[model samples]
Target: MNVYAKNILRFVVIVFLQVLILNRITLHWFPEPAGALFIPAIYPLFILLLPFETPVWVLLLSGFTLGVTIDSFMTTAGMHACATIFMAYLRTNVLNALMPRNLSEYINQQPSIKTMGWMPFLVYSGFLLLIHHLVFFSVESWSAASIGSLLLKIAASFVTSMAFILVYILLFTRQNVARA
Candidate 1:
């Protein structure tokens, strides 16, 4: 399949999964008054997995579109857009740092555990997801007074989101289990 077709499919599928299923799941380990409130989000994986050659403008646009889509569904009032766009803005720097060489060196490759190796791919995705969650939770709370609550929300949401992301890779990828 073509990259555009595949990405479009990813966009639809991830958005559906997020809006229909993941959004309905509200996780809390403690009482509402004590701990953080969040849901596990895997939608950010769409932005993370785009082809290496994708331009920054496309990333920004895609991120905005995706975030706006989710916000429209959740009625979060552009909170998701703000977080996703920030993450999109940082994607290039994160990829460049985690990548061994310039993105040009990899013609047809997109990021995955297969291409970037386990550690680098994890760091790349993890860092970005953390940024996304941090911005999202911080914006949701919109306060610096409760640093503990903000950190708890970020960490909890990040871990939850990453778990769902791993399941997504395990279920969806073609060579995820096969050795090259």
Candidate 2:
């Protein structure tokens, strides 16, 4: 399939999985911090998987669309939109900072375990995940009284999201390797 077709498919699939399946999974039983803390949002993986050559405006628009879709389903206006835009905006900087100096030729490729190496890919995904989750949860609980609980919620969500993203990469990234 062509790149545009592939991206469309990926966007649909990730959004469906996120809203229909993964969003329903509760990592914890009680709502100590909040009931929403356990929902693992893997949809950001779509943003992460975008081709590196994708323009900044395109990335931001895609991120905004993706986030708005999630927000529509989850009934949290602008939360996902803001977080996803943050990730998309910072994606290039993270990629440039983590990737090696001589690897500019790979700039147009989609990020995956096979192309970027497991460690670098994880670090890249983890950092973005942390940022997204931090912003997301903070926005969700935008009260000074809940700052400490928000921090904990962000940390927990980050760990769970990283684990999910790592597992996803391990399972799906090999296709890119085989093609390469």
Candidate 3:
């Protein structure tokens, strides 16, 4: 019920969905010869939902731990770790730019459509997800050999991840809509 306990539970649930469920499904938008596909990752939503007051050190540490956990399960070496950490690093800046007030004003609140409204929240999460996907795909291929293919993979994965994250917000974050 408390924030810490809630976050801990969220961490477990997101990772469970990512590792056991989403990881099992792969999306292929391109033909077989191109071999461009995507595996949507909703785990970044954990970091996105963390409280505004969480320290940078804590963010980095959490990102590393979360990424390492996924890496261990999915066995992609350290690709997830690398991408998550990078997303964590840029999270604050993205929030600052999108938010009208200082993050300190939002100490008691987590970023969500209810708190920040849909556009800002989506932009914040979308930008970080983009960073995560870019870093992840880049590290996976470890080369720019197929620039088109890489971009396609990133785009496909980003879109899928965003859709999943939106569904998650709608289902779990809760909304209080009042008709005026």
All candidates' lDDT scores? 0.90, 0.84, 0.90
List the RMSD of every prediction in angstroms: 1.7, 2.7, 1.5
What is the model-wide C-alpha lDDT for candidate 3?
0.90
Model 1 alpha-carbon drift over 4 Å, by segment: 176-180
Error of 3 at 176 (Å): 2.5
Decreasing TM-score order of the candidates: 3, 1, 2
Better of 1 and 2 by TM-score: 1
Q: List, residue by residue over 4-76, the lDDT tens digit for candidate 1.
A: 9999999999999999999999998667765756789999999999988789999999999999999999999
**Sorted by lDDT, highest first, which candidate order results?**
1, 3, 2
Candidate 1 overall lDDT versus native = 0.90
lDDT preference between candidates 1 and 2, better one: 1
TM-score of each: 0.95, 0.89, 0.95
The list of candidate 3 runs beyond 4 A from truth reads 177-180
Residues forming the 10-long window of minimal summed lDDT in candidate 1: 171-180
Task: Give the CA lDDT, 0 to 100, for residue 13 in model 2.
Answer: 88
Question: Which pairs of residues collide in candidate 3?
Answer: none
| Candidate 3 weakest ten by summed lDDT | 171-180
